[model samples]
Target: MNKKGMAASLLTAVMLVSAGCGGSDTAGTGDKGGADSGSASGPKKVVFWHAMGGANTKVVDQLVADYNASQDKIKVEAVFQGSYDDLLSKLKASMGTKEGPSVVQMYEIGSRFMIDSKMVTPMQNFIDADKYDLTQLEPNITGYYTFNDKLFSMPFNTSNPVLYYNKDLFKAAGLDPEKPPATYEEFQKAAEAISKTGKATGGNFAIYGWFMEQFFANQGAEYINNGNGRKELATQSLVNSEAGVQTLTWWKNMVDSKAMNNLGRKTDDSKKAFSAGQVGMILDSTAALKGLVDSSKGKFEVGTGFLPKPANAKDGGVVVGGASLWIMNDRADDEQKATWDFIKFLTSPKEQAYWHINTGYFPITKKAYDEQSVKDNMKNFPQFQTAVDQLHQTKLNTATQGAVMGVFPEARQIVEGAIEEVLNNKKSPKDALDAAAKDISSKIEKYNKTVK
Candidate 1:
């Protein structure tokens, strides 16, 4: 049976289970009429669960400390909850218990699941109640979190994909390091030249589906059907479209020609290859800028450019990738209000500026860029400006806003598997992608039915 048919067959069974789960309409609102109605007697304690570690953990800790120090009404206890996948697993397991945090940080791909779970207060609820002005936020950043005309969560730590290259390698290959490729054709030419030098692989293969998504966006192509799952519940995958096939074919040819290193599906391996000067170029999230710069320090100069597109394409843009803060509906009204307050404090211009400077994540609030600290930081690390520019230049559309579906994470894995098959020569690009798309369609269909 086709994916839609399978979904239809399972809908009744899925609805039976879904009907038993509780739903929450008040996402960020506590029991109070508004955020201001939080307990007046003492500071309300709010627990925050997140997946940041290493340097990111330190930054988050400092932000929490600063927030705590700045206010006595809401004391936020930030807890590290392993990786994004780990956090999602724990969150699912804790839904039936009182152990879930009041505010949770969820990765972008989990947005659909979070909304369907009905376990949190939507930020729109709080915004409407408090008359909060969302104009201060960058539209492109907020666009990803906005679903069905409602902003579900507060965007935080947002990043975009960019091409990172070694300036030294570019110059050695007799190419202008400053003039990074603006199109895939140029990129291929540059990659070929860099490979001929034998000093490094021309490009590093990205194991994740993120690069593929970016390429699709660059081509103004949707990753899934139903307007990238924005117009309606998506029933199919579009990863086997001509644009996708072209992208995978290009990648396959690059790998076969030895212009790009096939580092498998491990992002760390690709990152290591690039940082060790074994590769000249790589496509990675802007969030890796700080670490990439630090690691490449004293070794070579690091440069960044917008993700390349087809030279003939008329329009291109990138989707925002990162986590956002959501307030759980299980908390007291005051606690929910407290969580919202903490979220506001974190997204404030000063705090966002601090975050943008310390961590490589892009500032969501527009005013954050106006801060002197952010300005000076950009001056020091000019590479960050490329990301900022790329975001501003992005044309907002369903394809660029990113796909929204409960099974997005699974869909990503399916795409990765398809990429692996093509890279390993087990299947042609079209065949591999067609199979993956079918699998994703089945998963999406099942998820949509299960949730409804």
Candidate 2:
């Protein structure tokens, strides 16, 4: 058969399997609880599994409750399933069973794995069927979730990394509070000055692997081969490339020069240090802006800046760092549709505005900015405008779109281990990155083989 014919046949088979997963259900049957309808007296139900914890959990619960109350045709039950890693693992364990979630919220790095599993109904399918307008959403956010010219998931809460600094510390160190560092050298200088002045340690960055990936993108460097895995399955890891070496070397030098503190792997620890005025600057997600602002309220002033890059680099930007919502294929058509409805409601401009102010995550829809609440939020918390400006100024490219691999979660852990190895003097920058690249490449090969 020709390529087009083969593609059509594969799609038919996939659809058939998906249909079969729902079991037999008579159309227009209200007595049975399958795709056709719910109980004889109520609406269809959708089980949504998510990973929002702590104070965020209450916000999620409220959203779910509001969604449930808004309509009687569909009732969504949102369940908090621990961290992102835990949620993905639990989904894996429940696959091919009758107890799986109808919809799941997965992190950005899990995209390849979710697609490879073939257990999700692509959001593009619903968009096409419903004639949904994708233009209203943030182009960069949708770009991150689009693969093979298809949007696999609906972007719910999207964010990118930013530089968080203490304005008081900057002023005390004889530096301009308004001028946050934009490049590596400037950041290094500021850090050293702050540390030397006894105001605070220059900075404290959590040894999070996401930072390395962001750094790579900021340099217009790909993390994996095959167009950052968007063109095709990535067969190699580029964690040892020039950009990677430069990133690690710079980080290690900061630690060695006492300009930055290596605050282990927990971002919370670094956040705490900064909040306590023990650290002048730290790197964190835009989602943390609200919390930092609230925590630093009267004690000190907080400032945000774009993620720093090398001085000479001019063509790169940070990748999206949050999660998206996916529809599970095993769910009944009614359940899936109800889930999609809930998703649409959640991403609506008004809801997005509510989510943006209540949480630090920026709205995924451009229309959300027009909401009076969001405008007031920007006015009240101008530091958030820095992240918004940085996001809009970014240039879309293969590097900035981010790498996709079935083994991305594992790859992140491997990169984080390499960072530790370099910082602790156990290995040179080149050697550590070379080792990480080799390890991730092997894992990628294994993951590709399993998926095939």
Candidate 3:
């Protein structure tokens, strides 16, 4: 059969499976409890699927409860959908049916795929229809969701990578604990100094592609071709370029010098190493600050700093890393309207400040910083200010805006494998990166064809 025929068949199968599944009929039932009817007997129920768990789940639950209590017209039910990958898979399986949630929290890498799925109503649609003011939100945070002069989703649980260091270890190494490394060279020097003391490993960054992505952004380099996939659909990966090579080479040298521990790709393992005082420094997300601080309470003093950049790069910036909320298009008009109201409530200044305080994620709204609760929280945990300052310092260019591609999850896996190979001395940085790029190019080609 033709490609179009195959695509149609697949979509039909998906819709059939979705319709066969049974669940609570709370979502997409706009007529029973809609705000338009002005019925006080029951409120419209909106289902929200999210990937948050553990401590973060508590905060999300509180936000849902608060939103439900604040209004009589709408009630939201928060559902935990495992990890981001799991959530995406389930969402895909449930598309074109009433079983799907009215709204979903999708991770950054899935943004491209979500757009291509054509199952979501772009936030811009509601914004334009209502003439809603979005000037209060942070431009840098919103830039990640904006593509081709359109905003696709609402920025939520936004985060960026930051340097976390053991202040006590730095002091013991005869380095100034207050002054963290600001450049790549300075970081290397400090790493060497800490390594010489033999009390702790110099650094312990996770073998994850996110850090490499941040490094490329710091150098104003694109991760994928065609302007980080913003100008057009990217045909290939550019992660094997000069900037990428330099960044990988530096990481390799640090490992060789026993200055940085190769902690594999597990973020938890690397975080444990740092919190246990086995490593003097580490690179991790700002979302981890609260957990790290809490874990290292009696062990040592934890300090936060901006991710170091290469000396020659004048435009140093980091990509916003996290998830956003997307409203499903299959819902009723009232359900869609109710979903938008919940999204707005969640992103309001008061809620943003509360979220930032409970979780270490950055507040997407600019006015959230001016809130007294936010100001007091920042004062209590001054380390969070480092993340805030770094975000503000970031410029909204194609590089910093981050790559948008349909096969980003697969690409990240390939890159992570290359990093592991380089760290293990199985392949040189250039060789591994070249192989990974080639593999990613093939994947991207296959994905583009399937979508077309």
**Candidate 2: misplaced stretches above 4 Å?**
1-37
lDDT of 1 at 140: 95
After superposition on all C-alphas, the RMSD of every candidate to the true structure, in Å, is 6.8, 7.3, 5.6
lDDT (Cα atoms) of all candidates against the true structure: 0.81, 0.83, 0.83
185-221: candidate 2 lDDT, tens digit per residue: 9999999999998868999889888889999999999
Q: Rank the candidates by TM-score, best first.
A: 3, 2, 1
Q: How well does candidate 3 score on lDDT at residue 8?
A: 36
RMSD of 3: 5.6
Whichever of 1 and 3 has more TM-score, that candidate is 3
Error of 2 at 291 (Å): 1.3
Candidate 3 least-lDDT 10 residues: 16-25
Greater lDDT among 1 and 2 belongs to 2
Residue 325, model 1: Cα distance from true site in angstroms: 0.8
Candidate 2, RMSD to the unseen true structure = 7.3
Badly placed stretches (over 4 Å) of model 3 are 1-41
Q: What lDDT is reached at residue 224 by model 1?
A: 87
